[model samples]
Target: MAHADWSDPTPAAGWTIAHQIAHLAAADTNVLIAVRTPEAFDAVLKRTEAAGSRHADLEAAAGAAKPRSVLLDEWRSGRAEVAAALRDLPTEHGFPWYGSQLTATLMAPLRLMEVWAHGQDVFDAVCAARRPTDRLRQIATLGVIGRELSFHAAELPLTTEPFRVELAGSDGRTWTWGPADAEQRVEGGALDFCLRVTRRRYPAETDLTAVGGDAQAWLDNARVFL
Candidate 1:
């Protein structure tokens, strides 16, 4: 893409295409820090806390100010560092993250969802098409796992009521969660479900079907990220 192409606006409020990629790079760096050293992670956390809610926007803007090639290279470097750190993480340990903690196993899918969700914004902004990948299963899995967290974030009461989710995969297969006989059911294409789960796309914009009010409300507030 041309340098000017980086200025393209995405669906995320107040974020240009460059900002989206920059956010990923910053997030990758934070993940690397968290995985490698809890002490360094806490220092980074203090810096972000001082910025209040603007920390993410500020980080993205800083990276977005760099040249496209520089930004891309930095992102690549940070991603590789995070990948290695995650692989080397001890099995019995979890890392501090945004006032919570996550094991390497869970953190990996969360990062994947973050990248894919932001990548979707870029694709939508440029009107580019992307083929659905098998990796979407990981995202959907994260969505399923994060349902309770999202519900709490949305101020919805926690309910143990199980909800079934059925997705038609791009690879000509059906991926499902919960019991087949569950009353609350969500059905949709895997891509659509992934998009909605990340809040990159609304339920109405996708082919998702919610069989119960609770299920519909879950879709309305779906978000895999903190």
Candidate 2:
């Protein structure tokens, strides 16, 4: 999108198209720092832990102020560097992130999910349709594994009881997680589940149906964040 389009508002409240890209840049930078220097990452965590969302907003605002050409080049270069850094990391490596540890293997997929999710906001802002692709499999898998992440971040009580998830993929197939016979189950379109978990759309607005009270509660609190 052009500079004018960058000013256009996205679905995320108080955020613009530029904000989406800028946020991505900010997040990618954090991932890069985490992988490269643990001590530096700890410093970052210390600084941002106090500011929280405000810190992110400030970073996005700063990134948005740069010239479009500069922003694109910087974001692109940083992402490529991050990819290279991740590639060099040992498969068994673990990095501290946002109050938790993340495996080296999961970083790439998590980054992809963030890119797609933020891109959705930009696409929506510009009235463009982005077709769902097989990449959603990675996101849906993250959504399942990270179901408790949001709870943990929010300091909510955690649950050990598992809930079954069954999603109808865009490719006319089923993707499932957890025990099939679990009493609590969530069944829905894969796209809807991804959007719900990403906090892009309210669960009530999606095609998902919750089969149990716990399932509904999970749907409400579930969110994708590193």
Candidate 3:
């Protein structure tokens, strides 16, 4: 994913343009570090959870640092640093994060989804609409991530059948991920789908649809880590 301009020119009420950018940067930095070092990441996660007590606070703190200008610069610099780190990572090298081991290469796509999804929160907070690109690749990847997480969180058996997830972009293009003949299907706009699984946007706020048993349950608690 290319770098998006961190500007909300005509932002609505509640937050300035800078706050949104800073928020994304803060989260990008944390995930970047976690993917790089498993032990350190796990320790940090435990410590943070202990400090916050509530999961909401933990999520909030990860992206709630103030002073929008500093946040913007930090986001730019941090993304560059993580991008370089990802370039150096070998395919075979794996790091444990959120209770799963993932290859280093997957970090880029994962972080891309994270930045895009959380960035949407800032957008909604500012009341601006954005038509996302043909990012089907990233959206599909995120669907898989969400599927795995939803299953793990619910402690449900992974269904033998596959799922078909389709997201229609703003340009009237369809981006489909997963299987067609599966136990479940979640379909909606790419941006809305991303937001829904990310838990940043509630089902009522987006056009997402969930079919089959446990699909809604899965979406309810989807996360990178519990």
Q: What global local distance difference test value does model 1 have?
A: 0.88
On lDDT, the leading prediction is: 1
lDDT of 1 by residue, 104-221 (tens): 8888888888988899899888888889998999999888887897898899997788899999988889999999999999898999999988988878899998989889888888
* RMSD list, candidates in order: 1.5, 2.1, 5.2
Worst 10 residues of 3 by lDDT: 1-10
Q: Write the per-residue lDDT of candidate 2 for residues 7-74, one digit (tens) a residue.
A: 78899877887777888988888998888887789888877878876887887888988877788888
Q: How well does each candidate superpose onto the true structure, as a TM-score?
A: 0.95, 0.91, 0.70
**Regions of candidate 2 where Cα sits further than 4 Å from its true position:** 2-4, 150-157
As a whole number from 0 to 100, the lDDT of residue 146 in candidate 1 is 78
Q: Give the range where candidate 2 is weakest over 10 consecutive residues by summed lDDT.
A: 1-10
1-226, model 3: which lDDT tens digit per residue? 1233434432323333454555556556666766665567877678666866454444444443455455656878998987887778787678666656777577777778767765666566556677767664675566657677678777887766677777787678887767777768877787776666666666788887788766665666555434
Error of 2 at 142 (Å): 1.4
TM-score-better candidate, 1 vs 2: 1
Clashes of 1: 0
Model 1 spans > 4 angstroms off: 1-4
What are the lDDT scores of the predictions, listed in order?
Answer: 0.88, 0.85, 0.64
